[model samples]
Target chain A: MAADVDVAAAAQAEAAAPLKTPLHARHVALGARMVPFAGYDMPVQYPTGILTEHNWTREKAGLFDVSHMGQAFLIGPDHETTARALEALIPADILNLAPGKQRYSQLLNEEGGILDDLMVSRSLDEDEDGALYLVVNAACKTQDYAHIEARLPANVKLVRAEHRGLIALQGPAAEQALAAIAPEAAAMGFMSQRTIRVAGIKANVSRSGYTGEDGYEISAAASRIGEIWDTLLLDESVKPIGLGARDSLRLEAGLCLYGHDIDTTTSPVEAGLTWSIQKRRREEGGFPGAARIQRELAEGPARIRVGLLPEGRAPAREGAEIATPEGETVGTVTSGGFGPTLNAPCAMGYVARAHAAPGTRLDLIVRGRNLPATVAPMPFVPNRYKR
Target chain B: MAETRYTKDHEYIRIEGDTGIVGITDYAQGQLGDVVFVELPSIGKSVTKGGEAAVVESVKAASEVYAPVSGEVVEVNSELEGAPGTVNEDPAGKGWFVKLKLKDPAELEGLMSEGEYQNYVKTL
Candidate 1:
């Protein structure tokens, strides 16, 4: 769930030839167990394992080599053209996205289904007022670029930067260690973005992460990312984490994974991502799927994503069915696993609106047997993102 | 002498008389990463060789521990019910999934000896 949902395709890609990230050598040096993720050979976990890494990030700092995620830029003549071009594809208030600030939104189809979830950051550079930096899920990068390119005008170009390496340093101790390299990064407010020199290499740093924690994601030249990575590790508080803990951390934060939690068949409204739609977009209704999204926003989705707390230690894996106690199938789990922080099994899935409220009793059909569970408010663990 | 044998699926059984102590190999535990929970069969449950005898859940995924030999479950490892991580820490000792009374000790012949298993693992 940390990467692509179709792991079979990733496995076939690996068999053909697994693409290694810029930090592959470093991951191997740190004794990481690598697996094919989103067409790249990614570290699933380090020698310390996932639980320790998950808890370490909560108590200390955990470094993640997410260079496999796609980085790109949208170009136009000015902020209005750029934001407007992007708005045509996504349903976020891009025009209002202040410079140096980043916003989360989903790429939707005409049917109101999510094409992909991404982060759009208005460039902080005064000279580049027309450019927007975008980070998209790796597996969807190809189609996503094509999707945007087909829609935008000739002046608004899509620049896919496959040569950039993205690294996320997340945790409570992230600032304490990052300050040693780029002290300016420590001052950036949550969701703020800026370009700074990290370890003598110019990089784009964002005060945001998927981990629902205080963190920074540094985007640098693919070649120099290794240098930036090594420099950050010099601080003893940092430990290398991998996709395993990354998945658990994000799940505990109640964030949706693009391919699993939100897919082409799922709408933002059903995925509980109505928040990413700003008031203007909701009312103006210009973007793709605006009609259905606006209607769903007002009437509420028939089936909605909710958090499930399984009564015991058993994990309800993805694809598990959810049902009422007497045995009427209601929904299915999309992302379900153990929360290392809570030391309990928590899952996120779609259930009927009637069974979606917190404290609603339900049963998860795990391995064909019904297990007792209850709908719970998520961040199954409290979000510690530095506001 | 207590005889130890293994299945190609990475299950192991240490046979003492008609009693077999069953668990996964260290190689399996290594591949499984961190063990989060273990679902053991109930006492008196009869299992056939190659059938699911227990379920092991790791942080990454879940796998079924297959029975290496036909047997009736005698005692289950309660320690795993509380601390499933014991499987990763000490897979052979306290991590044994269940103790079973062999219904037919001859089923052990289909399993590999320690030396054969080590060589088999090398081939993998």
Candidate 2:
């Protein structure tokens, strides 16, 4: 009985401790500041600091360990079955998604609220047409998987690829840096995915990333991730960036961060992600919350997400109240920070439809003071994606 | 000769006559990462011991620089407005946030010396 109790206690302790990724040792060796994030002891920033890392990515290449993000595959008997199964949950028109292409979408509840935003990529190989690759945010993966599993038809299976480690190589020099190892990946267009040999290791490479800059997200076997990371860093242009710069880069790109920018309460239309939903999905009305989404598309969401440029050095961080010049509250900042590339404070927030237009004057209430801001257009820094 | 004292919060005050030049310790600047912005208190603003006198924002987050001892701010570092990186480059010298006219010299006894400060940081 005592032995069983001890074993139970040990299991409890193990579950409570934060999990370390395969690249944890490499991050430590590079003098990264480790912090708890998404149940993982992830690197927040390296000794080079966030500002330098942010600038380096804009000028050169930045490597990021995104292993904490959940990787999974939805498998069925054929492409149509699998696509239809996933379409029932998300509004993206997956059935028309060509092989080797990826589409971004969000899982929604019955009420049209976002469960989690994710990437769905169709298999590149014809023989594996039954499989669709999925990548979801780390913090929401557990619930996301459970939600997906419970709803998926018996013919389709959710295969969690927990053994894979994902990394993003991003910036102007990313292609050149990656071309040295994976020449085939360098030739792929944006949002394209394929199974390729990266540094002599078989891996899934996607010509896409959250940073708006041209980049690739490589998913390799956990055991070989360190080798891939090491080989990528050998290039003079490549530097290991942590979550800090990653957040700033995505915020500047005007991407929605799950839980912060979009949550269970925010719909894709409200978050300005309507572009991801194709015409077929919008008219057919088959997916969860399709009615509400279609209504929002025809009319407009009550509040819409927009890029906010605070008119000063002080950053209006998450939860800062967004108001009119007269102090009437219209919305709240979801993500805000100093953009190293812009050399200014940039943010994203949901404001009432009336105040969401670009160049509209607004005020952000930060620390009891009203800081002037303006509704700016997104991708604060122009996207450098190689089309 | 200037005698410097430190608080557990990592603020430092270098005393010369009745004036004290205040700034964050090198260790504090290192912990805060690259300083992107520094909000200095206005001159003539009176501060109490352990009270927040200025704000320091790094690339990741913002931190408050507390007053190590009570005094009236006689001067503020205007240079930080244009060059915040100076705090990371020379936190001990040019990064000085304010020059305070010491309200009570006895408060100095409550702070740590350089050696004590080093020992305290090691514990953290």
Candidate 3:
């Protein structure tokens, strides 16, 4: 009876109308196919289709409306106080993060499992030295904010930037396209952040993106974001991309999708994210799940995430079982799909340490058929990030 | 002239004497997005009405194309292995998935005519 009630509640939530982003009208005007994503009515693909958009992003600049992602500011009395407050939750070295620099990390539970993956950036202005800009997954923001708020000291506060909308311009030509509007953005290196005026609108521009391409993520007032999007589109090198290409591009880049790849059950060490944990946190052991993470760092994790290249055209989708040639189950695919850049099937999954090496042969069981696959290195397409 | 019939699931069967050429409709291909791979039924295999006949994979997901009526597969489109995008480019022409020997010609009467199928698609 209780299970049925829970199911009904879930159905009711699913039936609720999705919210629209600031650029929703632009997507509809461009004839994009809309789909429900992270509680927002998002464009899955434009009229030109996912293939064209994926290729366009690789060769040119592709503009993406990422307004649904949660943006907030962590405010405290000073940089040290703010960084230490955030470090108590995540494993990254926030205190050492230079001004105008961004770092990627995960909010971990007490048991070493990932709560959510996020990007943290230190403020560039000296007047705002105590503020840290945070970007988190759309689905987990509410809970993440509540969790952080409950644990934070009275001096530090979490301020949600509800009136802001975010957009990402990514690809090899992204720098040139953005430079046309904000010339200062051209000098910013990868993982750097700065506040700039984009066509007379105050915006926070970051030289970072999930796609392993040179790109910028610009955040501005929700009302003015549409103007920035329109101004960027004025560049012939920039084309509007949708979530479909976003998933494919990130998968090809070997980046993790929050809910699919890293979840509450997965740890940063097991997800190949130890690099994000700096030396101070690893040695000082002050953050949540530090013991488990440090132990997993010294003694390797039992299962580690690795890239899978399935032989042939058939894609091995998520939930497909990974097995030995003799049919022994070794792991399961967490994210799998057709990689447009590779022109082949690509996947990432957690496999036993023994079977995680590149060039290792494995089988992906799909539809009761054993498809041959190889354990390959990630970023199936080479990353083109500017230094 | 060959007669064409479409199932509610979007599979189409074009009757050519004893042989029936089968493929998904253009609307189905569009809904599936960019076709990346196609898994065709083997020749000489038997298929039942509404049974899984072939697999179509797009960049987004995979879907099954069911047989419109019971039949024995006579030939398959091997060219789709190398050029799966043809399924999106020419869904009705060269992109036909398979040709099957009809088990019963009368079964065609139960399926929708091209005009009726177009009308049905409008209601969706």
Candidate 4:
């Protein structure tokens, strides 16, 4: 009787918890296979499954409900002072960012390694109010906020955008879907953002995505997010995508996922993120580990990030050892997988500076077998962002 | 046609004459999602009951297929190396991983019947 009561209580608790998203009922109605992800019950795949969802994202439009990612605002007195305060904690050029523009940057530790990569967008209003909008990774949201709060000055504040729900509609037919729902969204250029009403739901829409396809990420109030998700899926081209397909799609695009391709041990220079650091920031030498980064920029870092093309059928997965022709271990594969578009195995890894060049032959040891590989260029499937 | 049996580890064995065809169950394939690669044991290699027979990798995770009965692996489905999705599409039919010449038919009694296998999957 006690065991049965415990089971009943567990079921009751699960039932009592509010199911997130406006489309939760729709997801269930469509027979989506749900899984727990980053504190939210999300669809990993629908009736079509992960493989079909992956292929659809590459060919058509795939709607991803990523409302679980953290959204917040950074407020300060002025832009310059606020940027400086932010640069002290992160490695981004928050000062030079013009209003309405967004920049992708990382929060770095004192050792110059990544804490998390986040997006910072300056608001478009006239006031020099350092009102910056940020979107951080879901898994590290709690720690990221705590770290920022502890390090920020009395004048600076980090406020969670708790009422918002973010969704990413990605792939080749994405623009069509967004245009159908909100015609004004078509004018938003790649990486550019705008505030618009998507199907009568107020949202901040940005032309950014993880699937290497033309798409937009819409952030709306939590109550209205599910409605927008359902509205978009009403279009013939749109289907729900899951985390399984998300990872494979990102891998194929040669994009880096935090906690996988990068960590606290990998510096921006070694991770092939030099372009994210602005010219003024590089010259001013004020950010964390600026001394080390400036030196590494001029003299070149010891190790560099490169894409690996594994020969034959087998995939060279994460943590696989990379070796030279002489059998000496040079580095390790950070992210690797089968590129669905390229129809071959592609990988990203760190190797000695000499081995970073494309066409450099390397050996990836997978399951005790040496898979012949070459250093290749990234984005195995070209990114079709609507620039 | 011989009666099919299942192991607790989620493998299925169908015996006919002295040969036994081994593969992962439908429930196992459903759990693995889309199988991308299948590493089969060498055709001539002998394996003991409950020993590792092959490696099956899906888009989500990797799983090892174990031998249900002691036998020498006489043949393997080389077609899986090219089309691994067969495991997910038709797990019980075309997705058979290997065929072994049984060393001991008595080992088959240790496996579960179809009814028992259904109950085992429910427990999972």
In terms of DockQ, the best-performing candidate is 1
Alpha carbon lDDT at A136, candidate 4: 94
TM-score of chain A of 3: 0.96
Top candidate, metric TM-score: 1
Model 1 per-residue lDDT tens digits across residues A33-121: 88887789889898889889999999998999988888999989999999999999999999999999999999999999999999999
Clashes per model (N, Cα, C within 3 A): 0, 0, 0, 1
Chain A (alone) TM-scores for all candidate structures? 0.97, 0.96, 0.96, 0.91
lDDT of 1 by residue, B23-63 (tens): 99999898777888888889999999888899988776878
Q: Candidate 4 lDDT, tens digit per residue, A206-253?
A: 889898888988999988898898898889999988777887788888
TM-score of chain B of each: 0.98, 0.98, 0.98, 0.96
Q: Which stretches of candidate 4 lie over 4 Å from their true place?
A: A1-26, A127-129
True contacts kept of each: 0.26, 0.20, 0.37, 0.13
lDDT for model 3 comes to: 0.90
| lDDT (10s digit) by residue, model 2, range B93-112 | 99899999999999999999
- Second chain of candidate 4: TM-score? 0.96
Arranged by DockQ, best first: 1, 3, 4, 2
Model 1 chain A poorest ten-residue lDDT run: A1-10
> Predicted candidate 2: what Cα RMSD to the true structure?
5.7
Model 3: DockQ against the native? 0.38
For model 2, the docking class works out as acceptable
Question: What's the TM-score of every candidate structure?
Answer: 0.97, 0.96, 0.97, 0.93
- Candidate 3 residue-wise lDDT, A1-387, digit = tens: 001011001111345898889999999999999887778888889988998999999999999999989999999999999999999999999999999999999999998899999999997899999999999988889999999999999999999999999999999899998888899999999999999998778999999997889999999999999999999999999999988889889999999988778888889999999999998899998988888999999999999999999999898888799999987899999888899989999999999999999999999998889999999998999999889
Better of 3 and 4 by TM-score: 3
